[model samples]
Target: MQAWQAGAHPRSAPGLADLPFALGVASGTPSHQGVVLWTRLAVVDPLDPRVHTVRWELAEDEGFQRIVQRGQTETQQALGHAVHVELQGLPADRWFHYRFMVGDAVSPVGRTRTLPAPDSPAGRLRLAFASCQRWEHGYYAAWRHAAAQSLDLVVFLGDYIYEYASPRSGLAPQAATPIHRVHELRRAVSLADYRDRYALHKSDPDLQAAHAACPWLLTWDDHEVENDYAGLQGREGASAEFMAQRAAAYQAFYENMPLPASVLVQGLQGLNQADALRLYQRHAFGRLARFHVLDDRQYRAVQACRNPSESSAGTVRPSRCAELRDPSRSLLGAAQEQWLAQGLAQDSRPGGPRWTVLAQQTLFSPRHYGGASAAAQADEPTPTDPWDGYPGARQRLLHSLQATPPRNTVLIGGDIHQNYVCRVHADPDRPDSPVLASEFCGTSISSHSGATLERAQALQKNNPHVLLANPEQRGYALVELNPQRWQTTLMAVDQPGRADSALRPLARFVVEDGRAGPQRES
Candidate 1:
């Protein structure tokens, strides 16, 4: 049979080589015995099929000398020359190491684990989620730290790659460098550009180690396509041709990431044609935690930054803003809103998990950081790119949480590149009002840090509901859960630019039973 033919093994063919270690072997969306293992073959030439039959072996030990499960799968350029092996018959809540093979070549081994069985005795689960790792700004020291700490999973909440071109003049001293190559100081255009972009960032050993460490649940934000791109409406004039180009970019994104077959085979024409996008999914960690990953950019309404001349210092009323007040405007869109509402409601039903986690991008809190007097100060204005920009939708979600609040609904977010701990109040103005839920916004893993220490003081003075806000920090959040309380620790790296980046505990928080918010824990 020909190499392209189904069930054809490449061992008999000439010039066949094992997958490159650059792609790395990793898994996602873990189940009891079945999990997804992924890898991308390096291409020296695009015309040649690069067709190879890869053998995957999983074992309980780091050294697969004692293999438990083994399988072989065919790979072709059609799927970006990527191999995704779904292994079954594995035990629950157990660690497994796997490797890929082709002809005489062997791929790097990776570690992965499966979720505990449903209704299994409640056990401890450790998960770390992060976002906004701009390549130009800093290094991925945080990801390295996360890999060192043994965790069950890592949820990447978007801005995985920036859509902007690098500054013509080098970045400011404190700024990050762009990961993708640029021409004419414009965003990337072709698939090769996007592919090379991922190649640049993925070259980071820390990020690769994190993927090798555990299963990753990922979703995209605006930067993956275009800045603040909402459907076909781009922030800076998304023409039809540009939209088509954006579609190409999205397809390239799928080709590069370690996504599943279900997600990879979504549409017919190619992986990029609607069918390959896997933005949202739910993962139940036994009966302890339920994570609802979301896709905000695809369904969200295009955002418009508020005019600086129209507001005050402490409380800028954004209700007059067209994008903010558009009731039809949605951050999660109607479909995703329904999905979230249904998930929230289900978590409260008997037999559901204790914590209903929203693994999403961007802050869900309503905060006007523009400082009330923008109208008089004539500053540019507040970037209405967050939940603060979609008040109606925010209100809708808030009301949903308040009406039938889940047992423990905590929203984990990223994208703004800051750490925020706030009590999600149904009414922020009402100090004594019952808090509906709590939000633990993780700072960027290695993105730019804001003036967190300084902003903490201003936020305290302006927003009372926010228990703590750290605008200056490059770190990740570790969320520990139990039936009674949820403990979260903000772990920050001492210096990302330095080679030996040391991490330390920046802060800790805990939410007691029945409380709608978190408190800084001693």
Candidate 2:
């Protein structure tokens, strides 16, 4: 029972023109004891400055007949009237119903569950991993299907809201479907602008349903703040102006998310700076699995060999640029790398998690986009955004895995708007190197891809480790894990523009208990 109050409550209930719970309810970051409940008050005016009292309740049943706990909290204009209730000390491994109330209005009921006890014997885990949901590209039929899967959790690997606006030109070449929606602003630059963009995205019924369905473990990619932003630097370069914009965007992201208040407190402690928000964390589901949620965009080194005139990331030949081989440049900063190494070491111990899950953004394996010959590949240009750009960092990560290998390591990610099922090797360039893990990179939810089936096939011919690559479909990945095997079903939508699109399995792959690579099942 915690609350923030500026003054005493009003004597009479204040009336509003519409329901305040227009954006809907959500829950996230579940643990053995409890989970986080979230909702934002959507009023008639965006500039409402008054403090409003919001009451919340947790129940053993949906009818509120068996109330377990209840509390009241205050929301104001500063925090965008968003409410986050971090519940703890509750019963573990059970379903609970929750909702919010203000005056006579009540929010919709949401269902959430806690993870099994750490020492308890858990059998299985079911989850869906998705990413890159641009509002303008297509409808959220993929989210609707995900909501119906009865999943235990949803791991969202960033690009939840794109930074683009309406009438986006030069997108027809990559987009397979027509634009179904448009952004409210040309580009989000201020706190208000970012907030409005989040509000617009949260207004979708399918996205809301997906949030309400179960708890989500999330991490962001480039588009949340800006496309191809690295550390304190933007595409244009590091500046005070870009830092201010980053501060605003980070604040907006915190207010709209179902994150705990401690994250915000940590951000403010940096001399009232909002440029950074701690997002990388770890979650455990009993002894069955451990999820290492990583943030790659916030602390990465700038793209190597970038053109000075155009500071944004682009393709470059690694053989021509010596910086591409520099050992100091890292995709994950030194601190984060050390943290991950320690976590990996701990997971290899006895009574540790059976499955080690690395949930992050973008593809992990090396992608060669040039000719088949070694000399031609060395001369061909490759994108500097993914792991291929920072070969030394990739080598270090693979070295850590080889040093302290976890049982049944699995890596899941999304970006580039294409689905790839690959075998992560100790050294991707060497064919004889040992397979360290199995990777499943999902396609975008609504974002477009310029890749074709023929192009994907040709690329796979050059990279034999990639068992499957498909860019023609759009959907999410359904992963089912147990003691014996891990199964992934690639769910694809028939028509992305239609609201009631039918979903089909694009492909299926399975990894056995002791195997390090995924075997194509269909």
Candidate 3:
């Protein structure tokens, strides 16, 4: 049994050491002078809905001697005994250490940094983007490696946790087996179940280290609640029951993440659950880059008439479903689309950001058939679970970029387990179409991609826009943004399933100033 799950003691029965701060420490959503901090109090039985006061502090140094900002807050049972401190009035573009204290219990110190002045000419940013981490899939060696890099920021795209259930008692990773881990409950159906699941995943040392290493910008894909749920509607249409389930899931998500209170799930605002939580937001690094974090799932008109939850429904040709051409349907919804357009337009005008990055979940660029993998070669429809499934929305996004293309725009996405480098085109069919931006689809931290290298090579041959594809590796993209160029290193881990795996630099691609496509750096 894990240390925190040792017994069935009541809330006040156990000492501070045995009862609180079980999820470690995390910080996120950094502005030039503000950031959010997070942690959940642990207990022998998490069901204890008692109020616990937590003290938090910020320091310029790792040691607590140099105190900067300190305060206290109480975690209420209504919010799952969790705390999110949105600290403001800090300096710009510098590192800070922070921690939480619950009575005698203390959390590990975490490092976080605010963005530089909006007009400052920032030098470089070494940021890593990752997504689709299924706890039951493999060890979090990738997170350990990322933590060691001392990244300024980590962009978590989605799938932070999976919904598969586990045993009610004696939960643990199975020995001598593939898919090494076993869950404790049935697929998470209630708020308590989701809380238990988060506690379980947070217990991993590597995950904790990653959280302590840097601030994170996170969003949920499907697994955070249910598989392929979009907006008020789920994989199955929205129902009163599903709304309740979604509300519970959203509350659980808010409680677990290091997000600001602005996105906190207060209660059901409407039947659609439109007011549950809003995660889509923007972040800019002075004149270096601007990141438009998107929410494709929340407001999307379910995946083009097909069930997005099913792997077999998406990845199709226009002939399979012609309504995909309907421009009225949107992935970002009309309001967010306009919001993104205006932001990009503002950035595209007169000596703006050196780079524009759409930090989101799911791949943006297209991947055609004729690859070596049997599936790729089968001439079957491509997966529509991502942008590929929402052609109209993708086209509109591409059209907007083409109209006012941002300088060295780069789209960073995750979901597909393989790594890919492609150039986005106004017309996906026209290989020579005006390149609106560049795309780097980072491979998964450890999720499985059932494709082979030979198939990937075949895909590259057929898809002219695709420059590189690695179907059988698991790792993240180490991105370095400079004033004149944006470089992304494909860091592939030797073994994802192994806890002691190592990350090796597989390839590097660079997009120079005023450039629209990637040039591989050897």
Candidate 4:
């Protein structure tokens, strides 16, 4: 199916015969017949409000040696100096390289690939999912390594850019966490801000290489907007004005992303433009695997970071029980939950596919460090921000799986900024029972690490479901799958600042048919 169905229109702007500083080019959300390509024309000074035409050429070879699809489109300064072209009629399951031109300026070349045939046979699939990259904390060394490897797809699970300004302190646990002036905050709330943010991120050679390497499936987490926002609410609290600000945040986000115009037309209104725009959709990787992308932050209830203290106690500390357990709370919301349940049921049918992978954010497994003696565990006032906080929502999802029981179901997640391999179960105590599923959570490409190694040792002992957990590492996880076996390599980049950062295999884990969990160090 074509991702974009073009309609007749009078040219809103002049054709590529005029512009300068053709900023960026990206091909995203590929499909059988078409792929969406993006380019933004930048005028040297006093960004003009003129119409400019742009042309994109997609080829089977890197040199544009074999052109398969070509198109010309116009961009207007009113539309944030951007051009989005959806090129159709390309063959399915093939790699294509595309470039854009506006006037005399040329955009960087990018590579994108389409989904496999709708009914192809189960064979092989390779994917890399990573998240929580803070540019100021470290370099994108792991992304550089990942881009060099051949892969079917990349799933970026949010924190694409942090909303807050740089932290004054280097680490997370500093006593006086340096905070940027609230007024000085560069929260991205406008089209230019979003464009500039993307430009800054794209300036990283590693991120550029990775985008050039494969098509990405993206989902937004709290950092993209405000921390732990529910619908239009903002942190510190929610209000109508806050919601308006949120709307601006969402619009800025859509403007910079590789999404189609349909999603972009929300116009600073933080509501669904179309019911069919499922942030969580299913994609088949040949016949080998199916991926279910999810958005958990959009539909959740506004959670108070900590419960208010009781008057009887007369203390300002958090209450023992926050409202996180509210039964009505949701992660994927009602519509998305239904879509995912239906997709899981249909994809896991007998002899349908080899694997069912849920590419999402946050860890699904429950972990508790309440009883730990380690400083890291004892120091933290609350549990990690994960699905573990929403027992009801997590249970609902687990029950959904229990009902469908897809064979070879695996969960892939990246948001905790740590590497983890765990066995997801309907009941963690009964690990030997009919295995529900398994999960591989990737560490950050170059973000803050979790607890120190000394503390991680104690935390791991308490969390048995977590087969492996590395908090101090910076890198990505590579999952290799075939019809019979699945293997994962957790590679850690030495450091980010150095130009020649090397990725080393920190751990290797494998899972075979009928196994509920992974076998470590194999």
Cα RMSD (angstroms) for every candidate in the order listed: 6.4, 5.1, 3.7, 7.2
Ranked by lDDT, the better of candidates 2 and 4 is 2
Candidate 2 local Cα displacement, residue 202, angstroms = 0.5
Q: Which stretches of candidate 3 lie over 4 Å from their true place?
A: 1-19, 166-177, 234-238, 265-272, 307-312, 315-317, 370-380
Candidate 4 yields a Cα-based lDDT of 0.67
Off by over 4 Å in 1: 1-19, 171-186, 234-238, 264-276, 304-320, 370-382, 450-452
lDDT tens digits, residue span 1-522, model 1: 000111122323343422354556668878766788887765544446647677888888987778888989877765566677777778888888988877667887789998888777566778888898776666778888898888888888998877556555443343344222222224666666666566556656788888999998888887777566665553244355566767677776676666765764455254334324656888888898888998887776656443333321122345444554677778887888998888888888888888888888888875645543435223323446677667778888888888778887888898878888888888654556778888988888666664557767786656667777887778899877777888999998887665358889999999876676899988
Model 4: C-alpha RMSD to truth? 7.2
Candidate 2 regions with alpha-carbon error over 4 angstroms:
1-17, 168-177, 234-238, 269-275, 308-311, 371-373
Range of the 10 consecutive residues with the lowest summed lDDT in candidate 4: 1-10
- Best-to-worst ranking by TM-score: 2, 3, 1, 4
- The sequence of per-residue lDDT tens digits that candidate 3 reaches over residues 409-462 is 899988888899998888887787788789999988877787889988988888
In model 4, where do residues sit more than 4 Å from their true spots?
A: 1-23, 45-47, 168-185, 234-238, 262-278, 304-319, 371-384, 429-433
Compared with the true structure, what per-residue lDDT tens digits does model 2 show for residues 445-498? 989887889999988988878998889888999999998999999999899877
Candidate 4 lDDT over 1-522, as tens digits, reads: 001111112233343213333345666666665667776655432255567677888888899989888879877665566666766777778888988876556778888988777677637778788888766656778888888889877888887876655553534444242221112235565445554555456556678778778887777777776555554333344355555545555655555567666654344342433322336667677667877889887766544343322111111112444554576767677777888888888866876667888888888886656543344333334442467556677788888888987768888888778888898878654445456888898888776764577566666787667788788788888888898878989989886545468889999888786675788865
Highest TM-score, which number? 2
Error of 4 at 220 (Å): 1.5
TM-score of candidate 4 on Cα atoms, chains taken together: 0.85
**RMSD of model 2, in Å?**
5.1
